[model samples]
Target: MKQRTKARSVALQVLYECDLTQHTPGQALEQRLAEEHLEPELAEFSRQIVFGVYPIVDKLDRYIAQHAPEWPLDQISVIDRNILRIALWEFAVAGCTPVKVAINEAIELAKTFGSDSTPRFVNGVLGSLANRLDEIRQQFQREKAQEEGLSPRTT
Candidate 1:
């Protein structure tokens, strides 16, 4: 697997463990990375993803619930939920990864780690979410602006 792909896989595993085991992100990631023995760069990338998703996990969950209302958050599989969170982080939060790349990587992850229907489910939800990414990003920026005591930028 490619570096980021491997990193995302590890990050997903870390997320799964954290959710199921109630372990700290650092603890989950450290344990998983130790077992996997990934390259330094890949490990660092996974670390970034785990840490990035940990803080705003509730926000991400809320966003997912808002977008994929048909699929209640609790009912979704742990693997799929974490996949969406990681992809959403890449798509709307970090904005470092390209949108298509993020969505495609998410689908790939679903195929590997999720159920038979997971890829399509992930694609549909993420596809819809990606369509509204700019709107979401703008809203996020506006919220941040308000918190910083500045008027939000007008488009």
Candidate 2:
């Protein structure tokens, strides 16, 4: 697997542990990475994602709730929820991974780790999110510009 893919896998496992056990991401990542032994950069990336997702989970869940209203956040499968969390982090916060890459990676991870319906469900939610990408991106850019004391981008 690619490095980021492997990192995402590690991050997902750690995130899953955090969800079930109420462990902090730092604790979960330390133990999990020791077992997994990924490369340093991959491990760091995985750690960043684990830490990134936990604090903002409430916000992420709100987005998930809005996008997938029929399936409440608590009702969603653990693997699927973590997958969405990671993808949403990349899409909205990380700002380096492309949106399509994030979505596709989530789908692949769901296929490997989730129930039979997981890939399709992930695809549906992410596809819906993708449709709003431009608007979301603009909003983020505007916020960033404001943070930097500059006007928001026009395009």
Candidate 3:
């Protein structure tokens, strides 16, 4: 697997564990890192994905739920939900990845980790959300600004 993809997989595993158990994301990530040796950059990327997604999971879920109304957040499989969260975070919150790249990476992750229908489900939901990615990113930016006590800059 590609290093970054591997990192995402690690992040997904940590997220999946945290979602289903009482384990803290930090502890789960630490354990995963210890088990698999990743290069420094890849490890940091994994950390970024976990830490980025964990804090705003509710927001991501709301967005996902909006797009995938048929599949409520609780009803979505753990792996699939986390995959969506990771891709959403990468493009919308972190703004470090292109929308297409994020969506494609998410589909790949779904293929590897999810059930038979997972890839299609993920692609469908993300395709619906793609039209409004900019809007979602701006909303998240404004919310972050509000939380940080800064004026939200209009783009």
Candidate 4:
């Protein structure tokens, strides 16, 4: 496995623990990395993803909720939700990992750690999410403009 993918899976396991334990994701990640046998770069990358994503769970949840409203956050499997969190963090926020890589990695993770139905469901959600990515991105841009009260320019 690629170092980042390994790190991300570790990070996701931490996220899964957080979901199961109700501890903060950052706290969970810190605890895991402090004790785990990971290289320095891997540790940092894992920390980056966990900390990078921890603060934005609500926003991520809302985005997933919008795209897959039929699957409530609570109803979504833990593995699938964390996969989405990782991919969405990479796609929507981190911008470090490419969207295609994120989706592929997520599908692989789902297959490995998720329920039998999770692979397809993960693929479905991520694929659908990818389809609307530009639209969703535009939605964010528009909202940011509205928040900043910046009017659109017209020549």
Q: How well is each residue in 62-130 modelled by candidate 1, as lDDT tens digits?
A: 888988888899999999999999999987988979989999999999989999999999998888888
Report the number of the highest-lDDT candidate.
Answer: 3
Best-to-worst TM-score order: 3, 1, 2, 4
Cα lDDT computed for each candidate against the true fold: 0.90, 0.86, 0.93, 0.81
Which structure among the candidates has the greatest TM-score?
Answer: 3
All models, RMSD in angstroms: 1.6, 2.7, 1.1, 2.8
Local accuracy of candidate 2 as per-residue lDDT tens digits, 18-89: 889978888889998999899898898998898888887886777788899999888998889999989988
Models ranked on lDDT: 3, 1, 2, 4
- Superposed model 2: Cα runs more than 4 Å off: 137-155
| Model 2: per-residue Cα lDDT at residue 81 | 94
Q: Point out the higher-scoring one by lDDT: 1 or 3.
A: 3
Clashing pairs in 3: none
lDDT of 2: 0.86
- Residue 76 of model 3: what lDDT? 94
lDDT of 2 at 31: 93
Tens digit of lDDT per residue, candidate 4, span 43-94?
9888888887776678778888877877888999877898998898787666
TM-score of candidate 1 to 2 decimals? 0.92
Task: Give the clashing pairs for model 4.
Answer: none
Which 10-residue window of candidate 1 scores lowest in summed lDDT?
Answer: 135-144
